[model samples]
Structure formats: structure tokens, C-alpha cells
Target: MNPAPKSWWGTPRTITETIDNRKISWLELFSDLIYVVIIHTFVENLTEHFNLFGFITFWVLFLFFFNTWTNMVLYFDLHGQNNLRNLFFALLQVVAIAITATFTGEAFAGHYTGFIWAYSFNQLIYMYLYWQTMRNDPLHATTTRPFLIAYVVGEALLIGSIWLPSLPLQQALIIISLLIFVSTVMSEHRNFDREFKQRQIPFELNSAILERYGLFTMIVLGESLAGIIEHMTAEHTHLADYTHFGLALLCIIGTWMIYYTLMDERKIEADRYWPISFFRGIHRFLIACLTLQSFFIGQTLGTGQLVYYRGLSLVTAASLLALLALTRLPRFNVQPLATWPTRWLVLGIIAILILQFAPVFVGLLLMDLILLGIGILNWTKNV
Candidate 1:
């Protein structure tokens, strides 16, 4: 097979040649910094409101941003080159996201027109990138087609939403567009194995793409740290303040320990299609849960209400569910540990569910202990 055409700009790397050797690019890392800002804005908005409606809106916006990130990461992983054209594309994405961030704080305040338009522009950029990929990389047309159509239609819906008279109607339109895009992504990944096999390409784990996922997760984890810092800087201090701080820190560290351990042994089971999508979908849920955990932690420290306490319990419980779901994926090399981590994670989940009715600190402390136990058990088993 001939290499894809090259220009003054770099040639798109073929999976056949580069999949085994691809490395994350500096430009990709830099673009990810912009997302840190984007996520912080959304998290700040939720912190300010701290209500049911705010929680729902936060996740919706998060899903929208996450969908955009997934598509961009896929494009860069599959076809992106370190060339002038790709740099230009990355800059456009950053600018669009920055503009979107400016409006995100006010998105729920009847000032969402800018956010919608800027986000639509971001999708427009993606549509162009996918169209270019489809033309240049004919071998992956099946994979790129769903993304191209989704971006076109999704952006159209978002652009149309700017004209709606009611805020709820506009929000509904935005959600519809997100649903269309997300469903397309999940559907394509579900068919990933069959599609790649039809093209006579054996599926393998793309380490560069996996690094992108890990990097994004790590960036979002910073939200938890940010909350901890916010709590530490309070003017007045008490023993309870210090206790909440320690629990929150332990929760963050525990989550980090579990995620990276699982990720260290991660593999791609290309024979099955559902697990491919399932893995990505679960990471999405996990990232969202971590952000929610940050919010609940800070609220529990400041307000200390039944609602905030319960929110902390529930969010931490949901994070465990995400972890448990990840363990079930066949991608992990579980034979070495004798399946100890999976069993412990389930016990942790059950314990959290029961303790959620207790104080938030009880659930948080239990989570830290469970995660620590998993780590200790893994270490002993390996020894």
C-alpha cells in the first residue's frame, strides 16, 4: 500500500506504520491546557449555584465538552500530523474553547448565545478536520464517517438553538445535538473491530491515544485538588475543617491510586466491539464523578448540610461504580493479581452504598480505607 499523500505540511501517519510507535505531541499537550480552563469554569459555576438544576446543567455541559475532546483526540490519534496545518487546527480549537469558557459561567443566566455560537464554531472546526481525514485516509473512512456527519448535524442544531425564545428550549436543543454526537461515537466504537477487520487491519492498543485519555483524566483530577486548596485557605479554622481536609485529600489520592493502577495494566480487546466503547464511556463517567466529588467535598466543608453530606456520599459511590465497571473490562491483564482488585472494589462499592446514609465523612473515610486496602492487597499478592 502507498503512503497517504504528503504536502509542505506533514503527511498523516498511517496506523499500519505508526500505531506501534506513536507518541503524544507537544501541541496536543498544550491544547489540553485550554481544557483545564474550560473545566474550571464549569466547576466554578456549579460551586456557585450548588443546586439540583446546577448539577444537571454541569453534567450536560461536561458531556458536550467531553464529546468534543473525544472527537479531537480521535482525529489527532488517527490522522493528525505535526505540521503547520495541524498547528493551525489546534490553535483554532484553543481559541474557540477559550471563547466558550468566557460564556460558560453565564450559560445558565440567559446569556448562553455566545456559548452556543462559540461551541458551534468548535464543531465546525471538527467537521472540517474529519472531512480532510476522510479524503486523505480512505482506509479509515468507516471510522471517520460517523464523526463527520455528527459534527455537521450537531453544529447545525446548535446554531439553530440560538434563535429559540425560551432558555429551556435552547438547552433542550443543545442536549439533542450532544446526544446525536455521543450516540454516533459510541455506535462507531461498538463497530470498531468489525470495521477495522474489514479493512484488513488488526486492532491493537494505541499507546499514544491511551496517553491522551490518561492526560485528560489527570487534568480533570486537578479539580479535586483545587477544591482542597480552596478549603485550606479559609479564614477561620477548626478541628472539623482539618478533618474534612484530610478526608478530601485522601479521597483524591485514593482515586488517583486506583485509576493509574488499572491503567498500568490496561489493554485493548479488539475482538469485542462493545468493550471498546464501554471503556471510553466508563472513563467519561469517571471523569464526571471526580469533578462532582470535588464540588461535594468543598460544599461539605463550607455548608455542612444533610444535602451536601449526602451529595458527597453519592458522588464518591458513583466514582466507585465507575471503577468497578472498569475492572469488568477484559482489557485489563487480571491474571497476575488473581482477581483481588475486582473483588475489593465491589466490596468498597457495597460499603459505600450502605454508608451513604451515614455522615459524608464516614463514607469518605471508608472509601479511603477501601482504596488503600486494594493497593496493599495488590502489593502483597504481587510479592
Candidate 2:
């Protein structure tokens, strides 16, 4: 696309866009920094209530957050003009994230009016940005309009839900809103193949998109890394505390190995066979699991909450399984999980889950061992 309009507050010229450069710009990094704050807030909320309903709420809010973020990323990938207008909108996104984070608690408590308005406002800007670009690229804009409609109606319900005195009614409204959001994703993706085939709108993935995805995944895991660093440096002077902290750090390293092993560039063919929705879904789940693990570790190390140790094992094992699914190894180049090492790892995760229900420390020890086994498998594979 030609540079965003030479004037302030104008759309970019998409007609001339080509696949020449694919590096993450400084501005994109700045924007992603803002996104980390949002993700952190979500994690804190999820761990604040470690129950089934809390998990459900986390997933619901996550889908909305993911949708808003994906649209913005796609827009910039396609039509970013990199002018004051784009920067200004990016700043607006930061504010929107802050508002959502601020009202996260109330939203979960059924006082969602402010949160809905904030979310709706964010979606509105996304639509406007597309509208600006759509003047030059109607086909792409048309493909995204369904999502725009869904956001509008969903926000409207969110606003109305505020007046609902009955808790169940408010919950119903939110549920319906979530369903609308789901439909938007499904509808747009369902038509994407047809739209791309018929319209020939120069849609293709470059290495940078994959790089961005990987970078985002790293950012999420960085939270885990940060927690580990903090715990190690804290004043846990007793021998047992020191030992547990060391084991926790090892598990964090193990989590890193699981990702770098299966998701290395050797395994992921970003150019082909990667469906965006699936890719995003797996990454979201991966982030969720890691976030849970980090929270559990922090709680254990901070308050000596040994009870959360089993929960930590569960999410760490869950993350391993989810990452394996994401690697698509069985269907793609690598051999299936039936491989000896991989099979034992799966069995190991199951064993941890069942055994954790035994004496808590027993489960925690086994979890750490399983992680160490994974790291060893990769590190010594050639040896």
C-alpha cells in the first residue's frame, strides 16, 4: 500500500502493497509492550479465583481480547501507514487496554457496563481504521465487516446487561455476547478461503508474521521467567525453601525447552498449512497454561502455599500437551507422539496428574522430574 495518506488521519494505500519487507518495527514492539500489561491483568484475575467458573470467565474474556488484538495486528500487517494517525490509534489502544484492566474485577462481578463500553469503543476504532483502508481495498474490508457487526451488537448487549438486576439475566446477556463474538470469528474464517480464492487480494504470510507470533509467545513465557527470577532473589533463606525455589526455576527452564524444541523453525512451515485460527487458538491456550503455572509458582514461593503445587503440575503438564498438539508433528514432518520418548512424556504428565492427588510433595517432586526428563531428552538427543 502506498504510504498511509500523506495527510494526517488518512488510510494507507493497499493497492501497491508487496511482500518485500517483514521485520518487526519499533512501534510494533511498543504496542506489544502495552499488550503485556493487559495479559498480566487477565492472568492475575484468573488465578485470583482458582475454580471452574473462574476458568470459564478467563476463556470468555480471552477470546474477546484475542479478537481485538488479532484485528489490529492484521490491519497493521496489511494497511499500516505508520503515520501520526496510526500512532495515535495505537495510543488509543493502550488506553483501551488500561480501561479494561481497571474494570476487570467489576466485569467479573457482573458490573460490566464500563468494561463493555470500553471494549465496544476499542472495536469501533478497529472498524474505523478498516473503513479508512477499505476505501481502497473493498474486498478485504467486506470480509471483515461481519466481525464489525458482531462487535457492535455484542457491545449493545453488554450495555443492556448492566440494567439487568437479576444475576442470571446479566450472565445470559454476556453468554450471548460471547456467542456473537464466536460467530464473527467463524463467519469471517469460513468465508476467508472463498474470498481469497475469488478476490485474489494479495493475502499471504511472510516470515515476520511467524516471527511476531513467536515473539508474542516468548513475551507470555517471559512472565514465567520473571516470576522465577523474583522468587530466586527473594529472602527464602531456609534450605527447603532454597531447594523448592531451585526446582521451580528448573521447571521454568523445562517449559522453555518444550517450546523451543517442538516449535523451532525446523518444524513450523509458516508459509503453508498453518491455519490462522488454529494457530491463534493454540497460542492462547499455551499462554493460559503458562500464566496459570506462573501464578501457582508465585503463590507457593511467596506464602508457602504448598497446596497450589499440584495445580502447578497440572498446568505445566497441560501446557506440554497443548504445545505438542500445536506442533502438528504427527500430521506434519515429525513422527507422531507414539515415538518412545514422546510416549513416556505423555504418560509422565498423566502420572503426575493422578499421583499429585497423593501426598502433595510427592506430586510436586514427580512434576519436576518429568520436566527435567523433557529438558534432558532434547539436550542429550544427539549425545
**Could you estimate the TM-score for every candidate?**
0.90, 0.84
Could you tell me how far off, in angstroms, the CA of residue 309 lies in candidate 2 after the best superposition? Answer: 2.2
lDDT of each model, Cα atoms only?
0.74, 0.68
Clash-forming residue pairs, model 1: none
lDDT winner = 1
* CA RMSD of all predictions: 2.7, 3.6
For each candidate, how many residue pairs have backbone atoms clashing (under 3 Å)?
A: 0, 2
**Tens-place lDDT digits, model 1, residues 263-300:** 66455545655556767788789888877877777777
Worst 10 residues of 2 by lDDT: 265-274
Over 4 Å off, model 2: 1-10, 13-16, 46-48, 199-205, 228-235, 266-274, 303-307, 329-345, 379-383
Candidate 2 TM-score over all chains jointly: 0.84
